[model samples]
Target: MRVTIFNYGAGNLFSIQAALRKEGAKPSVTKTGSGMKEADALILPGVGSFDQAANSLPMEEIREVIRSGKPTLGICLGLQLFFGGSEEGRAKGLSLLKGRVRRLPPSVKVPQIGWNTLNVERENELVSGLDKEPWVYYVNSYYPETDGKWVVATSDYGVRFPCLVAEKNFYGTQFHPEKSGATGRTILQNFLKAAKK
Candidate 1:
């Protein structure tokens, strides 16, 4: 399948593109969110901050496309942008899902880098073959705060927050699947498999 990744300025394109290619996907990167409809799937990488990423691109088109169920995968900051807004900045998010991004509480270390366990809350295609407690890599200080309806799995830092979310064709991972080793590959494979059908 052809997967298009919307790069929000320096949006870790290499690693994600590599991941996609390893899964036998024809992946391409676009900075302007151009030619999204032509691809079988879309991706929003975990790169810049909320304000920088959202303001740089034409969000209206991207927002509607994902909402239309184009089979999307969002990572880290990419996941945060799915919400309505963020405490990270004044810029508004895609609001594809109703919620807000908030800074991680001071109790735990900020920028929860390295591997963290994913506690599966329910079964979903994104986490279809994942181990019960998969340790995924994360590098962020902010997280999405939203209704539990979309959340399929969660992880605890300073607080328990959604680690994997799936609503309609939109799937988001607060942790980086590309950086999560074998478990990550399975998740990506599942997404590609689902998009094919």
Candidate 2:
């Protein structure tokens, strides 16, 4: 499949691209909106502050992609950007999904950077072959706070928060599937399968 990786200036594009390639996908890394028109699927990958990434994104094109119902996946900060806004910065997000990204409570480690188990709350194409609960890697200080309507999975640090979310053709993961080993690969493969449908 032709997967377009959106590089909004602060993402781990190389690793994400490499992972997609390993999954047997043709990934094109682009900072501009040029080739998005031909994408079978789009991935928004990020590893920095929410506002920085939000400000750099080509929203109109992204919205068009979403409107077309092409499968789109967001990773890490990319997941945070799916919300209305974030506490990490003043810039607003794509607002494709309802909610805001908030800083993790002070009770837990600032950035929970390890393997955490995923509590699958609902069945979706994103976690097709996983167990009821599976372990995935996460590296973030903020989590999306919503009413659990779009949350398909949750992970607990000190507080249970959204981990994997899906709304129509859009899907997001708070963890880095590219770095999460076998389970992660399965998630990506599932996403590709969903895209083909």
Candidate 3:
């Protein structure tokens, strides 16, 4: 499968590309959203702050493509971009879903780096074979505060927040699947399978 990873200039591309390759995917990187509509799947990788990444490319055009039902996966900051805006920046998000990205409560550290457990709250193809409470790698401070209708799974820090969400063909992971080991690989493989259909 041909998968395009849209670079937000500060994107973490290598690890994700390697992960995609392991899943039998032909992964390529693009700084802009050019030709992304042609790919079997698209990824907005987890890296960088909100404003810088949002401004690095034409998100408006990219948003249209994603809404067109092109299979999409967003990780960390990439997932935050699915919301309308974020407390992290003045720039707007794609607004594909109704919500905002907010920082973790003061009770927790600024950046929640390390492995956290995924509390599967709902069923979806993304978490198909994951443990009920699988541990996944995370390197993030902000989390998406959205409706339950869009949330497929959640994780707890100072508060329980959406960790996995699916809306039509768009999916987002608050944790970095590329670094989450075998469990992460399963999630990506599921996405590829769904995209192939």
lDDT of all predictions: 0.88, 0.87, 0.89
Residues 1-197, model 3: lDDT tens digits? 99998887554589999999988899988887777978999999887889988889689888989988899999999899999899999998899998899999999987999999998877788889877668899999899998767799899999999999998999999999999988899998999998988
Model 1 poorest 10 in a row by lDDT:
4-13
Model 1 scores what on Cα lDDT? 0.88
In candidate 2, the residue pairs with backbone N, CA or C atoms under 3 Å apart (3 or more residues apart, or in different chains) clash, namely none
* Candidate 1 lDDT tens digits, 1-197: 89999877764579989999998899998888777988899998899989999999778998888877799888898899899899999998888887789999999888888898989888788777777678899999999887777898889999999888999888899999999999999988988888887
lDDT per residue (tens digit) for residues 1-197 in model 2: 89998877744678888988888899998878668878899998866678778788788778877878978999989888888889999997888988899999999988988999999888787888986668899999999998766899999998999999999898999999998988899999998888899
Better of 2 and 3 by lDDT: 3
Instruction: Order candidates by lDDT, high to low.
Output: 3, 1, 2
Error of 3 at 143 (Å): 0.5
Candidate closest to the true structure, highest lDDT:
3
Clashes of 2: 0
Candidate 2's TM-score: 0.95
How many angstroms is residue 165 displaced in model 1 relative to the true structure, after the best TM-score fit?
0.6
